[model samples]
Target: MPFRKFLGWFKGFFGKKKIIRLGLYGPPNAGKTTLANKISMDWTGEPVGKVSEVPHETREVQKKEKVTVKVGGKTIVMNLLDMPGISTKIDFEEFLQYGFSAEDAKQRAKEATKGVIEAIKWLENVDTALVIMDSTRDPYTQVNITIIGNLEARNIPIIIVANKIDLPESNTKWIEEAFPQHPVINVSGLTGSNVNDLYSAIAKYSK
Candidate 1:
């Protein structure tokens, strides 16, 4: 090989890598923020966002930058993006069941609608995606399918997270069976169960 060509190859091989933009995506109440918090807390000693039982509590995309994760001798630097939960519909009446006043529910519903659009827009900017699913719930849903389809269409590396495995009703197998084409890791974001498995997967699969 020519000396110039070899020198170029050497620099390229040892060059600084671009930071990955890792987006966490799922339907409402699927524990996206909880998992983001867990990952952030583990690597950066900080939480990404507040988690709430109320659907659409996270009405905007939350970002934690420069989180360095080291697992199994591999290190990856990423900008963790905790996205707003996606949904087919956001009705103010639903919040009433959670004791939200009519006016506040309406306002929340409006903000949530905007959030979903924002998340979809951010899809184009994502380098890798974690499509989180609630293992206790049925894996076959329009929201889940749409999320996966969008990521696949964008040719983004996908890592499915079967979250909430600490719950007795969780069936991680269902998620694996539903999307055999992608990698799945079962973990409990709330309790940190099997989170190491998730970290290893991230190191292996992230772009």
Candidate 2:
């Protein structure tokens, strides 16, 4: 079946009058913020989250509500939560790029320790999660696997968003093969490509 058609049928079968709680999560620079912004813009018709090129730009979780998504002929209400990027260690590279001294970078990394833990804690409460990944790169990071495994352990449904598929090096098939157990959708946040398919997929799991 065509990917989009499969998603549509999945949504129609499971997405009905459900108040979906979705958590957007990924490693640094994986386009988590971009995906969040696109979903917010598409459903709310406004920017509900910020988009930045730097890693860990979102320090706190941003919540938006009343996101109306039409899936399978039903308009489902969605509560979107945009979370800080999860990283095993403080992004020293990003910190140093900002002109921080080694000592200062170390200190900031220590401070960011709490943020990582908080982000993980937030995941436990979410009903569903979107694991964003950069399609241009191999999806073999420990952080990504940990997040996905934890959610799976808890029986929380997940959808992997292979963001940045429009990039020259993006490879969706490799990602699909890498994570054979989960569903993955190739998306381009910059141009809003495959955004509806993502919404429909999430709506399907929301049921």
Candidate 3:
């Protein structure tokens, strides 16, 4: 009994799992919040953030911590970060199309610009990043390249998620071709399609 107890203690000491800070980053309405919500709800039985059709809906850095996720029978503790939508330029006029008043639109734009800066600053804190991309759109955007380039410079682990794969317009091939350096997981955050694959990839790649 004593020997077994000592062995168990040794294993427990050596087998301590590290909590990975996983950031979900993408452009406007690309489903970063949705994916973060899915992951958080799947593991924690709760959501991390709200989803909206409006651009810059998530105008802040949202975090959900101590989420225990199971992937391929392996349990992982994760701190999920849902970052704001990043764009090369944010115009208040764009919000006018969404029926927002000029003042409200301008305020949202200001907050969104700040959110982008915060997301970039938080890159230093990310252990691994899941760069979410809209599968239906062109993948060769300055935002996507900038996000990937920054992650590359920091030597951070990246898992690109081609979100909205359930949409008929989605072409995962384009995203794959655009980012050949990292593994891409196709998922639909809205429909919860192929989310298991995402979990498996997270477990496999996120160190």
Root-mean-square deviation (CA) per prediction: 3.9, 6.7, 5.6
Ranking by TM-score: 1, 3, 2
Score residue 47 of candidate 2 by CA lDDT.
Answer: 72
Clashes of each: 0, 0, 0
**Model 1 agreement with the true structure over 1-207: per-residue lDDT tens digits:** 979447646765898655789999999999999999999999999999999999999999999999999899988889999999999999899999999999999999999999999999998889889999999999899999998998999889999999999999999999999999999999999999999999898888876
Q: Give the total clashing residue pairs for model 2.
A: 0
Shift in Å, residue 207, candidate 1? 1.1
User: Per-residue lDDT of 47-148 in model 2, one digit per residue for the tens?
Assistant: 756676656767778788868888878577878888788986666666898777988777767656766777899977887899999998889879889999
Q: Estimate each model's TM-score.
A: 0.93, 0.84, 0.92
lDDT of all predictions: 0.93, 0.81, 0.92
What is the lDDT ranking, best to worst?
1, 3, 2
List where candidate 3 sits over 4 angstroms from the true fold: 1-13
Query: Candidate 3: worst 10 consecutive residues by lDDT?
Result: 4-13
lDDT, model 1: 0.93
Worst 10 residues of 1 by lDDT: 4-13
Candidate with the larger TM-score of 1 and 3: 1
Q: Scored by Cα lDDT, where does model 3 land?
A: 0.92
Q: Write the per-residue lDDT of candidate 3 for residues 96-121, one digit (tens) a residue.
A: 99999999999999999999999989
